[model samples]
Target: MAAELSILVVAGGRGSRAGQGLPKQYRKLAGKSVLARTLEAMHAAAPAARLTVVIHPDDQALYAETVSELAASARAALSAPALGGALRQESVRNGLEAIGREGEPEIVLVHDAARPFADPGLVARAIEAARAHGAAVPGAPLNDTVKEVDANGFVVATPDRARLRAVQTPQAFRFSLILAAHRAAAAGGREYTDDAMIAEAAGCAVHVFDGDPQNFKLTTPQDFARAMEQLKAPSLADLPDVRMGQGYDVHAFAAGDKVWLGGVAIPHSHALAGHSDADVLMHAVTDAVLGAIAEGDIGAHFPPSDPQWKGAASEIFLVHACRLVRERGGMIAHIDATVVCEAPKIGPHREAIRASLARIMGIDVGRVAIKATTTEKLGFTGRGEGIAALAIATVRLPEG
Candidate 1:
């Protein structure tokens, strides 16, 4: 049976206690907004899960800009925007109602958008447990001794750490059960901190799964700064420097020609229209090299307006990029590129593309790699439109 799950992302909190001007979910963390990262993990766990983001009416502008980078699958799976109510329980009820409008799913996952670091594995496990037992939650084993104190400041019984697990999202449940539970709570004027609590109050048995220690939610200013520092200088061994840059080019598809991608000719009805053979793979690689060196891109070195470069082979662009890197006392270490298109099988010519790029960059063929994937018949490249390529290059910096 297909797993039809819906996600209700609660992002409407004012975060007054956290002292952030914007909601905690809207706060920036690790070079991107927290909500975006949370949504990313959710979509990765179940790409087809219907998404309903509960947002404050005032934060519509912020939501639009921050969620623009979400995967296409995620964007398509979203429900209409639902404005949150006065309390977390009310907000969740509103979100569930919005999702219910579009044919209620068998299972629903309620997640905190502020908890951007939640693992996709945890999400999957929660969903699996929910499927088996109707309710599931992820929790970390308690590490500290717990004590209960009365209002008069008298210490009570100590809770056992072995039996206690601090719970975390995503809390998954049967759609009908949670919907009724949320509505009943809202009607009775009860507000709970988490979905698990809401479920427990309603007498729903929740199964616990392993939770990751690194998936702490960002709440305060210090948490935000620490998350950024973690991304900038990761403690993991052998991580790349992670230099990033964007490249874009337009090429009209003309009739009666085979398209060459990453130096391999594919049996396409039309070729990319451009001067100098319009090889998108080479252009992308050249731009990546320039980006690595902090220099300008393909346009700066080979302008279309320049007569000398008109109709010139794109291999020269790759060759010139290698020369520039060598001039700066650096070497071409490796190049990995992906060609995006919908026509003329790309798998057959991947090897040839790798060899050609290796020759142009003057590196071993093993140092060059090419991959091809389609947009699954969606965007410009997906509709038998022109092809595009994205590339990432790695190089070792010399000792000063």
Candidate 2:
């Protein structure tokens, strides 16, 4: 049954009401385009269903770019986009016809590209309702009182809000039933707002199932802002995998007047000796971050054997480590580092070192903690012969 299911996403509107430029479906919400998020949600709900998008003729380039943003699995679920018509109803008809040519599906679902938050439960309910009644739509009960007004702006009637529902998609249907209804509507020169209405006009019984309130459509700039905030809000139900890693490093004093510590150059009696700028703090932090992701140490990535990194800045290593975390869909939550040294008084430059580390890691200064400690003449660091630093990193990754 899953293999026989198909979905059509309608995205042909100019979206002038949302803004002056760029269709709302193509606009970005968070870091992803609205249409990409919608497609990903639908794919997650019905992995076996064949997905298709209906788009305007002028939006070919934009459509391509949006599809490129999707994951490989989501992209694999999609068929070629069907060219849309002047009206939304006409566009849906074109999409249905295109799906028919590819091979008619037993069931079909029509959804709006601006609605990106549909969950798996809603889709299961939609499929079950369609199978039972032949046509179905998801609708949420209205919360506000509804009124019917006359042309003169006088209240004509106060309808019972108890029976009213605000409808949402994907509206599910048995394939042959809705195709005939749409064909009949087009032939009779009658246009309906949604497929359920057209099915009703064609004498078919349409069922209404419960809908999710978060499945609201994106229609205005305010709606976009709200969606961004909603995505940013952390939920316990989808908590990330938190991890911590520790790193330690030591560098001996060499024959230079300046030393690099946490990407900051400070005047000192001797420089730290290493392949790189030998910023002990930065190297320890970089190793800690890499360890948090289980991606080996800094030497494994940038080996001392490689002469290309002979005089490289330690910031390069830290930046590369952070980039790797982001590439894996993870984030560095916090970093705490303690420098072990008896010289170059770390107290006077603590804030500067913290600020420098934050800028290099692309995180806030508050997330980076810098502290200084001494072994009280009990270790080599107390003898002022070398500088040692230890770091602990916390990271969060998407739960597998």
TM-score of each: 0.59, 0.60
- Tens-place lDDT per residue, model 1, 164-245, is 9988888899998899888878877878987877888889998887676656777777777777764552221333344444
Q: Clashes in model 2: which pairs?
A: none
lDDT score for residue 102 of model 2? 89
Error of 2 at 235 (Å): 6.7
**The candidate that achieves the highest TM-score relative to the unseen native structure:** 2
Worst 10 residues of 2 by lDDT: 230-239
lDDT of 2: 0.88
Runs in model 2 deviating more than 4 A are 235-400
> Which number leads on lDDT?
2
**Model 2 residue 142 CA deviation in Å:** 0.6
